[model samples]
Target chain A: MTTIADPKAPRPPKPRPARLTTRGNTELYGWVFMRASGVVLLVLIFGHLFVNLVAGEGVTAIDFGFVAGKWASPFWQVWDLLMLWLAMIHGTNGVRTIINDYAERDGVRLALKSALYLAFVLVVVLGTLVIFTFDPCPSGSPADLLPSFCTA
Target chain B: MPDALPASATRKVPAGTLYRGREGMWSWVAHRVTGVAIFFFLLVHVLDTSLVRISPEAYNDVIATYKNPIMGLGEAGLVAAIVFHAYNGIRIILVDFWSKGPKYQRVMLWVVMGLFVVTMAGFLPRHLMHVFGGE
Candidate 1:
């Protein structure tokens, strides 16, 4: 004969104690870095935008000459360099979090994260190089192709 | 006596319980929203800026499209999202690391909001001036 449980019975013990999955404080630091970088990025990003798109003649004013003019100043160079590095790293970490949450298979997660990290490094390196190494007035270029300032 | 059914199988969470608009819950939601927004913006921004390498005229032409008044308004919204996300993100970090953080999370959130307001107050006027000021 089957016996039914009483409604007034006490609860049973849990299966096992929960163990932490994350190692040391790495994830903790990652969490903190997200916040710190985010704060800095707001300033860097907005300043870059204001100067580029709104200052002077607004977006229509942006061109090779405009960028060359801005980068000519060491201030804008550093401003842009900080913005590029912080944003890329912050964004990569954010996506890593997303992948951890959504990706079920370990192999898939590893592959995706590896690809993401590779893209992060590629873009950051290339963008940094472009910002610093850009030459508005290269010798031997067709005069017609260069910005007016280069000739002046 | 027969064993009782597992709590997971028998218990039901009410819809209201799931939908309760707690402060921490909303903060998490905003974080995800802002993170995604910035990620997408970065993709388009990088692609557009890379146009500079192709030709100056191409880069300038692409950037010219951003001059629309409508886009200016959108930029304001984007700034607000970034500010909130950044401020709240700091609060989250504190809660994870600070000794007294979990106990004072609500207080920290207000502090973050206050800082956000101050920062926006300083930046918005200049930004608005530039946006509305004629070329």
Candidate 2:
């Protein structure tokens, strides 16, 4: 029987395969994120539009007084809170993917992303505080400036 | 369930620590965070605005509630969220369609920072005046 050469044999290992030249599998994941986040954004955005623009009196009915009314309830508070958290995460992730795909320099990537993270944290923290602490009325307010319901 | 969200399917395969590939991964994380924040604001705004349909009295009552100091803070927060989301969104759009992706990255970041500075500058003072009185 003729002997065959070992293809599996490790030789010089093919010139050590160039330094810092490896294209890792990170991009595949970014592409997947865009598709996923896009789908969720579609739902969140469309649902938001339909509810605000189509339901009830439509666009004309919107105003400052209208806003004060909804925050009075716990159900709506929670609904809004969830929407805020989900959309921010989705949108931020989408942008982050774009940054990684394009930015070539390591320093630039780190700096850009650091700023993004800081902005994200500030918004999310502030938003959550507003939802739960919101009150429909306040003490010692001017009668004329306050909503008409205060007189009742 | 038909109402079940579609985004969940794609996110299931968490690109956890096991998959360290390239710089693109960071971008994905940022996109997700921004999307989630925007979604939250929309839901709240829609519901808050929905109060108008109930009645003038109800609407007025709700508006009055928003006068609380804590609620005022929240409003400030909402404004902050909107401004940041919009600013960063512009940056993302530029990178996507523009020819100057890398070149503009730094510029775009500064723009976002500038926007935050301007927005907060206007928003904070106005909010304080509304809540605590200018005097």
Candidate 3:
């Protein structure tokens, strides 16, 4: 019996030595970010959940006053600041990977990434400002709605 | 798996669209769009919440401002932003680390969309009620 062979067939080539370049290695750096950020996110996110939800009186204990109490100290403020920065960087890098994969045109990719970077800067700056500048106990706040600690 | 095209085979083809540089595959593109949206939301949210630290009057003023119809809509937009950012972040994590990541991008996309819909559907009603207040 004769067997039929397919037309338009491809024959595989023997492997050749791979070239290494800075550009080729830059991709390695991005891959590193995915792993590194994933690890850090695991810690930062879980720590946030633990402090906000599990510590003290649990979920019911959270409210405006609770938030005010935490921000009353610089330590909690810095803790939250670190969390914000890490999560934003982690989340942004993850999305940047996605954009490069799907955005077909150079112009489209440039536009999208430019927008992403701008927004990232804006948030990080604004969030850091808020955390550092926050004054949870303003003297002039209304006695009724203000946290009790504010009056003292 | 065509053998490396002979120079002769490639030479005669009319130029198709010039290949763009910095080609991102697919998932990276989605990741970026969600990242930017979430970042913008974070900026506004932090700024708004920061008012609470200024004074109770200022905080109440900001909250009351959000009750305005346009601001109410903006809050809903924020909910959407967070949902997309979180869902896409999870997708990236799964794809990069797990053996199944490459295989599951399409399914993950659908899952993200579905969760986005459900989250907004649940969140918007409560938000609207808060903004509009009871009859």
lDDT of 1 by residue, B5-104 (tens): 8777666653355455777777777788888788767766776776666666777677778766677777777777878877787688789779999999
Q: Candidate 3 residues B51-115, lDDT tens each?
A: 66566677666565555678767656755665665666677677777899878777887887898
Cα deviation of B130, candidate 1, in Å? 4.6
Pairs that collide, model 1: none
DockQ of each: 0.29, 0.05, 0.16
- Model 2 - which docking category? incorrect
Tens-digit lDDT string for candidate 2 (B1-135): 457767856674555664554434444355456555654554455455444444445555666676667876775665566566555655665676579966776667777778789868855765556556442
Give the distance in Å from residue B67's predicted Cα in candidate 1 to where it truly belongs: 1.8
Q: Roughly what TM-score does model 1 have, to 2 decimal places?
A: 0.71
A-chain TM-score, model 1 = 0.80
Interface RMSD of each: 3.3, 11.5, 5.8
Candidate 1 Cα misplacement greater than 4 A, ranges: A1-29, A39-43, A53-61, A105-115, A138-149, B1-20, B93-101, B114-135
Q: Encode model 2's per-residue lDDT on A83-142: one tens digit a residue.
A: 677666665665576678668699999998897777677666666776666545555545
- TM-scores of all models? 0.71, 0.43, 0.57
Query: Which lDDT tens digits does candidate 1 get at residues A117-147?
Result: 8888878877888787877776765665566
> Across residues A1-152, which tens digit of lDDT does each residue of candidate 3 receive?
99676776776677865854454576787677666665665566546645753455543344456668788877788778877887778667766777897797999999999988887887788778877776666565556665677677
**Which candidate, 1 or 3, would have the higher TM-score against the true structure?**
1
